[model samples]
Target chain A: MLPFARVTVIGLGLIGSSITRAVRQYMPSVRITGHDADPQVRETAVRLQLCDDVADTPGAAVIDADLVILCVPVGAMGQVAGEIADDLPADAVLSDVGSSKETVLAAVREAAPHALFVPAHPVAGTENSGPEAGFATLFQHRWCIVTAPEGTDPLAAERVCEFWRRLGAMVETMEPAHHDRVLAVTSHLPHLIAYTIVGTASDLEEVTASEVIKYSAGGFRDFTRIAASDPTMWRDVFLSNREAVLDMLQRFTEDLTSLQRAIRWGKGDELFDLFTRTRAVRRSIIDQGQDDARPDFGRAHD
Target chain B: MLPFARVTVIGLGLIGSSITRAVRQYMPSVRITGHDADPQVRETAVRLQLCDDVADTPGAAVIDADLVILCVPVGAMGQVAGEIADDLPADAVLSDVGSSKETVLAAVREAAPHALFVPAHPVAGTENSGPEAGFATLFQHRWCIVTAPEGTDPLAAERVCEFWRRLGAMVETMEPAHHDRVLAVTSHLPHLIAYTIVGTASDLEEVTASEVIKYSAGGFRDFTRIAASDPTMWRDVFLSNREAVLDMLQRFTEDLTSLQRAIRWGKGDELFDLFTRTRAVRRSIIDQGQDDARPDFGRAHD
Candidate 1:
């Protein structure tokens, strides 16, 4: 049996559109409705036929749905929840795919106190964004962290987990605050560092930008892919998850400082030891099937 | 006409083995001799038939060659140059594929001063190492920066560029010091940051190592690939290119500090603007054919 028979997906961006597509591919009998704040995106969703019905308003999208997933940026989650609060079906399970959980959970509770909310974050995405950039298999083999706080209905949380499982994600339950911290290290800090390094490389006067782009295969390009991620979403993520992100950033800065000192003092042993240990992490990531096993991410050499 | 009819490569690691394979594919008639300090690597090179001849010693490898390229770590360039000094051909164009040109240039000048030394760095490689991990197209469409000092023979420099071109790389010429600075920003700093962050993530007490690896697709895995790079080579690179790498690191740190402050102060606009600008750099890297254009480095979704 399908966990969600009629699902409404708000904010037809990458994650939102991917959910609509995945539902259609995996649970064809379930009705999919999509709504986006941007008229252009709404029009594109209709043009691309991403959903069974493209709703003109958030309220209309969730009025008859058994599940409502807010796929907007973290900063806008509360507002979107408020938009559909009045019209949402009484039995509908509210959820969100925001990167940060604690803030989103709090915002959502304040906006729709009566809704059965279950917050989740699918740990999958490409650098690309928008409706067209998403696909049905985007979440395949990826983790989906479900943060259903204390007192949340068990059935509602189980249904949320089942929905993600049907969409090809491995569901893991994490405490809201703990989820925020885990994502801070795994996602937020990486994007922040990538953005900073790419900016630094581009701003260098000694090295031409053309030269930077040309020799990027040396390592810089790996960062650019993530540095290229959607600006608004990342901006909201850093702001909403500020405390955990800042804490992780502080730790990263200390580590980086130690490395800088090692380089200055020509302490090759310290550098070598850390480099060797880090290699084992990559091995685990690949061995766990979290990444491509082939060299260079299996990027074609031809 | 070929750049050199007989080529000798010392250190049959990733870059060295790739050079032999590339030579056989692109310039089959050119004689190729290989040598490695490690007996196991030499055995692997011979077993894989990476070169026309697997010489027993560095001196024997270059004794009759028209061109000799050192593919060992930057820290070992001086020692390897001294090893081949007595047997190097008088008219041989000596060169190296070292990441840092300035140090290798000085080392070659000190040990094999009589030989024509042209320093070239092929800005390409995978995280994997050793002979079997290499391929003929590792340098295809990559940039090979040839840093030939002013006193070096013009013909020798051009030949080095041509040799890289034959191996399917686009060659550019830069001053040794400038090349060091450019690569310091583009390559060395990226690797150092990757190593540091991976170490930080793994050492975190709140998040399990397994959790970090499982959720790495969120962004951290992009780093692990480069962090998995050969430790000894990277250790040598940071030490040999100390000033440039440290200078770049300082700039990166300042930028990161500013971003960190923005995140703490909830400066979403500043974060959004920088993130947007960095996206263009990724576009340029893809436009220039320096990186794969496919989303997620063309990682298979299936």
Candidate 2:
């Protein structure tokens, strides 16, 4: 059974377009309506046939959608929700693919107070953005964190969970605040660190940017992939999840400072111990099917 | 013409085994000798037929070889060089695959002053180690930094560069100190940051280790791939490249601090600018063929 028969994907970016493609691949009979703030993206979505209908605005997109998903940046979630609120079906389940949950939840709830909102974040993406950069299989075997606030309609939440499952995601439920904290440690901090290191490497007077690019296989290349992610989306994520990201950043800084001290003091044992422990974490990630067991994250082959 | 008629690889770990495999694939007529400190690894090397013969000791491995490459931890480079010093052929070019170049050059010169030495670090590897983890094309399209000190035999250095070329590497020559500084920013700092972040994620008191592993696809998993690298090798790298790594780390920390403050103050513009600039680095890396342009480093398909 299809959880959502008429789905509206607002903001036809990577996540939105991916959901459109996934829905088409998994449930061919379901109707998909896509809308993007950028006319260029909407044109691309139409050319790609990512949705059955490419709406010119949010209101047109959600007027008849049984499931409305806002895939815009978190900072813009409230405005988008407000734009579609009057046209949204009373029975529609409103969700989003924002990385941060708390701010998004508050914005969505305030804007669409009468709508059945079941916020979700599919923890899956490539560094690329826009409608053309998405694929149907991007979420296969990945996690879809469903952050439905307390007192949310049970059936609405269940339908949202069912929707992600059909799209090939493993669903998990968590409170909005808890989701922000968890994602802050697992995603936001990593992206921030990657961006900083890439910036640091590029700004060095001794190392030319070309040299950094040439020798990136040593390890820097991996960080560059994440750091290359959409700037506006990440900026919104950091700002929306400020408290949690800052808290995690504090811990990471402390840990990095200790490592810095160890390097200065020539503490090989301390370095070895931490490195060894981290290897075990990678093993667990692979064991849980969160990543491939192939070495170098399977990047060496290419 | 082949650079050398005979080759010896000591310490049959990832780098060593990869050299053996690459040589066998690219230069079929070149006789290859392999040795490792671990008896079990030597047995595995022989079983895998990674070389023409598996030597039980470093001296035996280099006895008749015209090119001998040391593939061990930086901290062990001196000891390994000394062990093979008595048996090194006079005409043989002694080189190493150590991540740090300056200290390695000193160690090789002190131990085998009569023999020609050309230090090389093939900026290539997977997280996997030992004989079974190697493949002939591991160094293909990868940069191999060749560092030959002042007054070194130019002919010997040329031969080493030729050897790497035949094995499918792009070779670049630079001073040992200069190589260390460039790598400190490009490679060493990246590894150190990845290790630090992975350690931080695992040690978090509020986020369960299982949760971190489960949601790793968000970005933490990329860091884990490099963090899962051989601990002893990385330990030796940090200890040997202390000054350069420490310097780069300080810059990275300061950049991170500035970003943290931006986030704290909700300065989204600052975050967006840095993120946007970093994207260009990734683009340059892809254009140079240093990394796959495929999204998610081409891990999405798997």
Candidate 3:
């Protein structure tokens, strides 16, 4: 069954426009109303016919919608929620596709207190951004994490879960705090490290930027893909998920320091042990269908 | 003209077997003699017909070779070189496909002082290893950095460069020390960080191993691919390129610390700026054809 007859997606970027495309592909009868703060994005959404209607304002987007998904950056969720507060239907199931859930949950609750906020984060994305980058199959076989706080309406949470499932995502429900901590390690710290290493490589006095780019296939290129993610979205993620990200960062730094010591001291066993252990993790990921088993992450050749 | 009429490859693993296949594909007239320390690998090489002949011993492999390429762990380069020293043809252009250059150069020179030892590192590989994990086109369009020390025979260096070029690689010459320094940032340190992060994720007390593997698609999977690289090979690389790798690690740690502070202080602008700068490096990598521009590193969907 269709979870919602009318869906409003605010912030028509990669995630928003992707949702619009997915809804159209999977449930053609579901009317989509998409809105973006950037007029250019709204124009693109209209030109692409991403939704049944492209709204210029967040309020207009959700006035009659049964499901409203805020697809803006985590830092902007509160403002966007507030903008649509008066116009949102009383029984509408509010949701968001933010990277971090705790801060967004608090912001959304404060701005739309009467609305049922079923916060979610689809654990899927490419480095590309904007409405033009969206694809209907982006979320296929990926995870969608739902953060339903204590006392959440079970029916609302169930409906949100069904919605993501229809979009071809596997759904998992967790508390907002748990979701934040889990993602901090799985996503946030990885991006932070990727950005730092790319920045560090570029700033080297001995290694020319051109050299780094030329030899990046050695290993650095993978990091660059993650580092190339949208700056505004990542900045908001780091800010909104501060505590968990910091906590994970501390652990990562400690682990890295131990490795640095091992390399300095010529502890081959330590290095080998860690490298060997990590290989098993990659094997598990591939076996579980989380990633392709092909070499080089299945990167295509010329 | 063909760089060499007869080539010998010792330690017939991924790089060695790939060299064999590439020679067969590109220089069909060149006869290849292959050997490996592992008996099974030698048998497999013979079965796969990776070369014209599969020698049972390293000494036998280089006895009559016009050119000899050592393809083994960096730590084993010296031992392998020593084994072939007495059998190596006096006029053979000696070379190796080790990741690090300085130590391998010293080792090769000490083992075979009269032979022309040209150290080359092809900046190409997948996480896979062994004879079955190689392809003829692995080095195509990739950078192969050759380190020819002072007073080395110019003809020998040119021959090695032409050999790589014939196999579809672009060759650049640099001093051994300089190559180490450049690769420490561009290749070694990136591998070190990827290994460390993957290790860190698996060892986390709060996050279960399965959770990390399941959500790896988020970002952690990229690190796992690099970390899944041959443990012995990477262990040798870290130890061999100790000084340069350690230096880059220090710089990376400092940069990461700065980002950590920015996240703690909610300095969104700082995070955004660095993230934004890193994106350009990715663009340069794609433009230079060092990596594919497809989103998610062009990972194939099942």
CAPRI verdict (incorrect, acceptable, medium, high) for model 2: high
Query: Ten residues in a row with the worst lDDT in model 3 chain B?
Result: B293-302
Mind sharing the TM-score for model 3?
Answer: 0.99
The model with the greatest lDDT is 1
> What is candidate 1's lDDT per residue for B1-302, written digit by digit as tens?
99989999999999999999999999999999999999999999889999889999898999989999999999999999999999998899888999998888888889877878889999999999999988999999999999989988898899999999999999999999999999998899999999999999999999999889888989999999999999999999999999999999999999999999999899989999999999999999999898888999989787
Question: Please, what are the lDDT tens digits per residue for candidate 2 over residues A1-302?
Answer: 88989999999998999999999999999999999999999999999999999999889999999999999999999999999999998888899999999998888889878888899999999899999999999889999999898899898999999999998999999988988999998999999999999999989898888889999999999999999999999999999999999999999999989999999999889999999998898888888898877776666453
Give a tens-digit lDDT track for model 2, residues B14-125: 8888889888888999999999999999999988999999988899899999999999999998988899999998888889999999888887778777878889999999
| Error at A238, model 2, angstroms | 0.4
Clashing residue pairs in candidate 1 are: none
The docking category that best describes candidate 1 is high
Give fnat of each prediction, in order. 0.88, 0.86, 0.83
Model-by-model DockQ, in order: 0.92, 0.81, 0.84
- Lowest lDDT 10-residue stretch of candidate 1 chain B: B107-116
Chain A agreement with the truth for model 2, given as TM-score: 0.98
Quote the lDDT for A181 in model 1.
91
Least accurate 10 contiguous residues by lDDT in model 3 chain A: A293-302
Residues A71-190 of candidate 3 have per-residue lDDT tens digits of 999999999999999999999999999999999999988987888899999999989999999999888888899999999899999999999999999999988898888899999999
DockQ, structure candidate 3: 0.84
